[model samples]
Target: MESCDAALPYTLIGLVLRQPSPPHRGAASCPSRFLRDYASRATNTLLWICLISVTSLLCRRLARLVRLWVQGSRIPGPPSNPFLGRSKLIPGCGSLGSLTGYLAELHEKYGPIVRLWLSPTQLLVSVKDTMLIKEVLIKAEDKLPLTGRAFHLAFGRSSLFVSSFEKVQKRRESLAEYMNGRISVRANIIPSEIVECVMGRVDTIMAKGTLDCGLVSQQLAFYILGSTLFGDAFLDWPKASIYEKLLITISKDGCFWASYTIPPFWSREYWKYKHMCKRLKHLTEDIIQHCVEKYDLLSKIGHSSYKDNKDIEDEARFNDSILLDNMPSGVLLQEEMAEYLTSKEELCGNILGLMFHGCLATSSLISSILTRLALHPELQQKLYAEIIAVQEKTCKLDSDDVQKMNLLMATVYESARLLPAGPLLQRCSLEHDIYLCSGVNVPAGAIMVVPLQLVQMDSYIWGKDAGRFNPLRFLSEATDHIGTHKKYEDFEKTAFLSEPKRKAAFLPFGYGTRACIGEKFATLGISTLIASLLQNYEIKLQPGSENDPKPIMSDCLLQQLLSSPEVVFTKRSKRKTWKSKGSS
Candidate 1:
């Protein structure tokens, strides 16, 4: 059909030329010949112009691609296909495991900084070296275009996670203020809430005898975050299951779309993602509305206080613009900074982003940590002893108690290092070329990836036992020898890697300007939850379940750790299990 359309103009000219010459004596034939001649000339001229314009555009694109290819070739990497580039070598639409594995292979065969051609148009540079990754992360702020587009579709354009660089800075600042205010004031309440949530899960696990680690971890994370966002009302909310299901669906679909990069507008997957986003938005708004209505009675009765000091403070903050006063610190912070939120849509987007990002990452880490603990019972006993010691000192376990548990903190870091929730740290040089040390320059609009999984587990950096789950690796030699410290930070150097490379070597929460804002909260929540669980029950892998500790690397937000390891919660007895004070 396209060929026919192109030929139509030439066909008209041919027919006009083939027409029999008008009889010289007839005036009617003279006008007919004039019109045919004029039509043919105009058609021929238009066709030539269209052809020239198309050729010029193609030539220009070809030249740009060639220039990019030459620039990319300067860096060492596997040979790329001519027009296809490295698309065939590196799976664009494959799982995260495949992509990261391929990158690791390239870095091994080549060097730390290897050039990857995702397509003829898209050039990606994978940096596994800690030093180089630090440089790249510090300089790059924008997300990859295709990735940003995917996130924008799922979340709104004004979402804090996916926005322009300037908007991102503003959003980060606003969110930082909110996070800081909440953590400072509400720090006392969170650990107890986390413990309550985990203990509830433990009850269900005890009754069932066995449960999928993924499901348990996911529920715990959801419950914790839900409680913080919507307060106690969210716990009894009837539509909670539906909300969680929608979130899981949206998360999986979003990951797929982001990996596929650019799904056609008419594609089934694209429309399905769009449909899910609408459903998710409606559901999120409904949740917000329900919380508002539930809180309305408290506001009307002038009953400001709920439970204790924290509850009183929470009620006092309800007088602010935000409707969910019972939400305490996090919500109150947002309420206090109403000017930062421009509209309802942006607010909803931010809320959903918080739910999605917070729940997924925290859940994944929880699962990974549990799986590791279950597989290595010795580690669990050691950690349990540490928990016992801390429990002896405090009447109740909280964030302050978490700070005193050094091995617990090291275990969290070690689990994250071995199985990072976000396997790859993604950044984009969207507007300008990012110049790195040693004459290395990432071209404009290039995607910069720092494979955290590879870097974190590198033997050279973390020693021969890098693959092993050794929490002691994160502690200083003095702490390792002396047993315990008053605080986790008492160690001079926490990382096993020496000198400057140590901090950059382990980036479970990412690095630079765009590092996760909820690091402290996530750590506190995860550590507190683990400690409380240990206090009540001993975690063990279910009978006949494979205990493989290797994590499956993937392109999704959550790494596939533990291979669906199911665990049984065994209640701890009064008697001591191990002989040594804190020994397995």
Candidate 2:
């Protein structure tokens, strides 16, 4: 074997060193070396493939871990996908309101703070709880807001709705003047005047003999804001009209799909919404600028006129001094006003939010009241009789006549109890702690909320037969149960101011600093509209328009708005146009 190996090496070396080996000879020799090279490359390729697979596996695991970590310790929710979770349910709902309904269902199934997946990140949701809602809403101030990225697209970052914290805080402080009691008194003058004007428009709409409460409600609200803000030209002025345009733009189906989502930033369509929101922001800023200039001009005139009169008559001089002292300074006022508008983006948000949410609900609620009256036209006649009786007592057909319509108020209350706007309100968590009422302790960052729908409909709160729409439920006996809700601190205050006993039940306006600031405004507006409208016209449902506004529920979106169809409007059925005060 040794002799053979030595002979082989010589032969091999000689062959390798040969003058000119055939092309394949050198290429084909040494099969072992070639095999070794091929094995090395193959091993490198296999190693790379293994590395990629492991890396990918690790990435997926990490993403899951982050999702879980964000969800925190005690939050409860359904199992989620690595991508979208219940967010996938959105496509099936058929409308924006369906999302709310779906969320409500989740509350029933999983309880509050249900972690929902939207693009791998879990967003915890709570239905509604007073103190907790306050923390996320008012108590923490704007630090922890309820809005997500989706809303910014519809509203824009420059908007009060989307402004940064410093900007918002500045604006909130300024807007406080408008909201506070003294400044509110001045602001009141404008809305009242606007209301007087819109009443005429309502008469015309009523004359058409057909109406969709949603459309009518929208028109009325916009008309008020427009006319009040910009005097008579709001309808024609481009800038003032931005309010209506913005509302319509955001309410579009596309905007609806995008705005409620937390990940609107990920969608290209949202970019368009974002761009327009920027334009809106610019428009608002420009309006503020223009208003400041106008105020300056007016001030110069006021000052020059004052100078002209300072040396004039005694009574006039005193009056001039008083006017100058009482009148708000244009510069300070403008700056303050801008600041207020800025901070009050939440206020604007809440206002728009209330309108978006309240329009259908209020309309539906009104329809329900009308329906109950229709079923018992005797009650209607009796209500009209009461109106007439009160009018006779006063012998004057005045706005005060509405105060005598006790049955109508009772009917309105019963309807509100039966079908409130939202079955629940939501509050997000800021810290880790146990919420008291339900005896549940959700972890930090865990959301907590109350099912207002369930609470309102609860037998314990409203009595065993709470489901029925009984106007009697609104009697003093009913009012007793209205504000006793754990969430009605504002109502408690109102009740406290009125009488010694503080026993009202479930407050629909909510509680704490975040309670509806416009409650008084809304109460005044609706009462005036209904009372005045009923003053001139009799309302009856369109023929064949019955119990359920639409036999197949249209979801909560318009559940309460379209309760009645084609309310008959025939010039008060030839009844006397003029009557002594309070006479029906």
Candidate 3:
């Protein structure tokens, strides 16, 4: 063996080139070759690791985007803001009646299944997609849930406005059972009492020939609600008017002005709210205490738990004492029986909701209907004629007689069309896959809504004059029957042909099994009040007004009540006293 250490570098190169080289058996292989091998292997491994990570990230991002897009593509939805999704375009959502104008425009744009925003979240807004909406509202809406802060921001969180559903159901049932037989005189005693207190002021105002409609509406609503619900006996309409102002302030803030008050976790609004809540709490406590005291004796006698009474009849009949003895207690017990409500806040929330619904919805609807009637004297005349026909036929106003006013029903439906109380009410999503309508499908979990206002006014389904206010269009029944029926033809789904459904549009009440529990009650109240009023005096708009007195129509369906465009009403002179032009 040759000891040629100096030729190692050259020998190594020669060996790789397959040339014969002098053997350097005396020197071991240099350590640098092993180091080089490791360096190359490490570099290749790092490169592969980086490549895989980048590929995985891209694939995940692509998958998420595809899912959202596929979910969106099922319905013909409007373009949404990339950042805010639908909220940037929806205008107002939680605010009362804001949904009306939004849905109107949405229907105008997208056919039915619209991508919308309720709280800066993607909401699939549909009018007829009940199956999906039920899942959201009844099934999943609470998953996110309402916070105490949200309730306080809207209604002092101290009130029952934030109450859970279970509580309200139980309380209402208990109250109902308790008052079943004992409330016989409650109805008559209250109205007469209200008249005694308010009629004088009404007469005074009438004599003065000037009226504040907003104040009047609030007063009337408060008095009516208070008397009927709380058994308030001597509430003068003037004092009731003040109460109305307070509630109006609260409602306007709660329903419309929420963003201004809400702060992260807590708010300075709480400072203001604290004072308001103290007063409200005291007032509410007083009323509740009074109700509790009303049947304190009964409570004492029947203080034992209802569970102790073994006989079913005794317990059932005992509902009266159980409820009247303690208003809150009775309500809580009843709600438990009905729905297992757990929250006290919800109890107050429901009461507050009642106040809101009664004051704003009922009164605003009344006002809106009156406004339309005032503008269209011909329609009024027709409605009056119907009223007269009913009265004459029955020889008096009665339950059966009220049912016969088909024209009245039509006019009411018509009013709902042009000036709906609210454009749309939401139902949360629940199910996985949902068929919105024919040829349109949403994925398993979806938000469905029966947007009657939007669906009814679909120009494609309803024709070109869908924007116009017409009542007669909805009244058409099948003069000629063909064997073709569409699944969802008219808003009401009046009838069915074979393939395409028969046309009878205009569903103001709502769609499906859970429409509205109080539709009949509301209809009765409005018809009766309007009938009674119109029969006594003619309602006319004030002439020669200084202001334009034009209504500020909300583009959004559910607007704040105070924002409701005001109209002036001037009662007409008695018809009997008016003289003929020539005769005079």
Candidate 4:
């Protein structure tokens, strides 16, 4: 290829030489001096043009960089090398966990509100202060572009995780309505369904004697989510394992690729990743089609009419029958199909996102909680006692029973506090600057993060033993005092203190308008599984397994937790069990 500078001058010279030779004197009669002067002038003109263009380009880039530096300079953070920024802060190969840990360290050294520069153009501001975190989250509802791009290959453009704010909000509202209605109507049945699914997984683990709890828990979560999302239909899906494997692979690799901003077309491994995403999408479509066919959902949905307020109230009386008969398990009932989704792709994307989020986080959480339980047998007995009390109060375990067991809920909450599914909650301001009460203004396009784990584990906010695993801290009894009237008054005074602080600090699901919508459904399902497991067997760490480090929660972009600290499930000596209503 010819250089533009050289090509331009040569073309000008050729044109001058071919100008008809001035017609009269011809080429020979033309003075050599005139030709030399013209060529010299043309060369000079081209040289000056090239110089100005290069200088202008450089100046523009420099000005943009200067503006970026100025924007980040106002915030306190570790000094980074020019252009390279803080990329080296993350150790070898890097990971979501490593980045999170690095951010926490930065917050300690530099203040709660710290700035990080991934590059001259990419800036990240991490807020660990409770008040600031709440403000930033409330103000910035959009997710970072990097996160969206990372999972774009797998989740699709319309996924809840990647869509624009208005679209995401619209989709979320639609999904939330369906979820709220379904969960309310079937609340009692969900727990029993979860327990049955969990028991089957437990039987497999017990039969194996000493299996990796991570693998078993992964399968357990997958089964429960599959059932919850697709109902009994998923049990008959032949490619279920393949579907799970694809999800795991895509999720694990998406973060790494996103961190480096490596597009699929740029690497040799691109094909494999692309293939997995394609297969996952296809599988999702297949299951969706199967469910639609199984219930003749298309016809039913077509025939369904929009109910007015009075009709809705009347329908509420027969909600159970209407729900069960009109919709098959796991298939969402769309009030207005067009309003809820534009195409099957949108529905599939959301379904896949739901499955990915639920399976990865719930499984990891369940594994972590069980691992903690195995390590602390005394705690297990306490939890077991709580579960039994609830069971005794009711004939069979249900959503109501799950709610009554505060200690059980506390145990789950405590475990989540220690090992959160989302290590760092990320958001980006897209339209305007976010002004914090503390006078720090987060600029648009700058990635804002809340290091959820760091805040959750802060000793100052949670007392001296914040890092330790203690479920009682979450229970009301942990702060209760049975003493004089003065003590009760003192408790009343301090009650408001912790509640607001804890609300800001403890973010298991998240905060603000974008918080996880499936919190109640997930909690109920997890509690039921734990309760059912406790009823049949006692969880204990295998001999010498206690020496292994407790499994930690990874970033949401990767596997939630690896099953570690090998554990065994042995039948409890004295156990009480009841069959679900439909059980044989």
Return the top candidate by lDDT: 1
TM-score of each: 0.77, 0.57, 0.60, 0.76
**Residue 308, candidate 2: C-alpha displacement in angstroms:** 14
- Candidate 3 Cα outliers beyond 4 Å, as residue runs: 1-70, 73-75, 78-81, 84-110, 116-120, 127-215, 232-239, 255-270, 291-346, 382-398, 430-453, 458-509, 512-514, 545-584
Tens-place lDDT per residue, model 1, 441-538, is 77777778888878887877777667777777666663343233223343334533222225678787888878888888787778877876787678
**lDDT for residue 145 in candidate 4, whole number 0-100:** 72
State in Å the error of residue 58, model 4. 11
Residue-wise C-alpha lDDT for candidate 2, range 208-308, written one tens digit per residue: 75654444455555654443333333433456546557656764433365435365578787677666665655554454444445545554666666665
Query: Candidates 3 and 4: which is better by lDDT?
Result: 4
lDDT tens per residue, model 4, 1-584: 43323223234456466433223323342445455756788889999999999999999877866766787788888777537745474554233356777877777788989998877778889999888888888888888776677767666755466624754775577666766666543444444555565566667876867656677677778877776666555666788879988888888887776666546576778777778788889898887667546545433443354244455434533322322233333234554445435465666676777888888788878887788788778778877776777767666555666777776776788777777786678888776778888887776778888887788888777767777776666545454421211222122233221232255687877788677777777776787778877877788887866544644555455644444767788877765564443334
Better of 1 and 3 by lDDT: 1
List candidate 2 segments past 4 Å from native.
1-84, 87-120, 123-148, 157-209, 227-246, 253-415, 430-439, 477-507, 550-564, 573-584
lDDT of 1: 0.70
Q: Is candidate 1 or candidate 3 better by TM-score?
A: 1
Each candidate's number of clashing pairs is 4, 29, 51, 1
